[model samples]
Target: MTNPPEKTPENPWGPQNSSPEQPFGQQPVQGQPAADPYGQPQYGQPQQPAADPYGQPQYGQPQQPAADPYGQPQYGQPAAQDPNAMANPYAQQGNGQPGYGQMAYGPTPALTSWIKRVGSHLIDWAPITIINRITDPMIGGYDYASKTERVGTNPTLGFILLVVGFAWFIWNMVFKDGKTGVSLGRQVLGIQLVNADTGQPVGAGKAFLRQIAHILDTISCLIGYLFPLWDSRRQTFADKICNTLVIDTK
Candidate 1:
């Protein structure tokens, strides 16, 4: 065998000395950094920890809670307001005031005129007077050319006719006025009788009382009949006593 080359004084491991010229496949020198094979950082400088996308936590510090985007209560916290106790609009307000479409008091009535009242009275009496005049000859045998002379002849017949006429008057004033608040004459004159307090038709009983009170009115020298001309409510003495009113139906 040929003799191996002698070791040099500079290189302790002869021929294995890693030189700059023969860098490929070389071993690293002791106490020196090795070459990086994949371009990664070598030792001593720690890579700055990957830049935190989120902020870093400080050591020994308490963590702050996350903010609520919707401003709703947190998971375990109580709500701000009670869920019940809703609102209403039309429930009765202060001092018990009247509600919509309601009235606090009763309505007032319209009164009749004196001229119309007198006209209706004359109309009612005219037919009764004419019937008496026509029937006088058959009942009393008394004959007179004029109506004035027919009175007080044949007292018996005159009294009987008076009774019949009075009964008819009562019927007209009571039942007829009770049902319709109007008599033949009152209807012709477009007038009606009503209870002053109720503004409703005066019934039979009230109508009777009203007519009976008329005696007192007549006893006052016709002043009762003429009283309505200046009366505020168009009431005569009879109307005042019987609590009745005569109103224009039309």
Candidate 2:
């Protein structure tokens, strides 16, 4: 007679339990949702999306910019400016081009007064005049009919001195004044003659032409020389023609 095997007890729970066929884990029943290995939503329930690890926008979405710490003008916005900007008194105007009474580079200097100009003129001509007067007794007078005009005993010496005086006048008034913007007379008076446009010395060539332009000053009963008295910019006719200005340096 063989001994009968004892009957094994059946599991009260579902078939998702450990059994001889499923040795390691539970097996889901057929036609039912399987349990998630990592605790996901089960079947017949709405699923929640997985959270992004980097916190970035999803695909096909426009990226957002980070917030700015300081308040500043953004792209395509006008910049803010101070409303009460102070004006500069010496600032140039109109593209920095010289106008009738403007300077090309620096601020317009103070004009030389008419009296100062007269003093400078006298100083420049005083030496020449003195030499002429001293030699007048020896130089010959011009004879219109005879064409022979030797009246003094030392005519040759007097003529040489007169030529020397003219040379001195040209050297001081034209070359020196042109190169340095001042002559011996203007230096003593603390004034200078400069180009109105450049505020610099006119070259020797222009200086010589300016001297010839003085004829315009005397042509109109010396009114051009006196223009500085009432003229706005203190420019004579010659000064206007030559585009020069006499400015006080002191």
Which one wins on lDDT? 2
lDDT string for model 2 (152-218, tens) is 8698888888998999889999999999989899999999999997788998988888989999999
Give the per-residue lDDT digits (tens) of candidate 1, residues 148-199.
4334446676667768887778778788887778988899999999888777
What lDDT is reached at residue 107 by model 1? 47
lDDT for predicted candidate 2 compared with the true structure? 0.84
Question: What's the distance in Å from true for residue 127, model 1?
Answer: 2.0
Give Cα distance to truth, residue 243, candidate 2, Å.
Answer: 0.8
| Root-mean-square deviation of every model | 17.1, 9.6
Which stretches of candidate 1 lie above 4 Å from their native place? 1-108, 141-167
* Model 1: ten consecutive residues of lowest lDDT: 141-150
Model 2 ranges off by over 4 Å: 1-106, 142-150
- Look at candidate 1 and tell me the lDDT of residue 40: 64
Whole-structure CA lDDT of model 1: 0.76
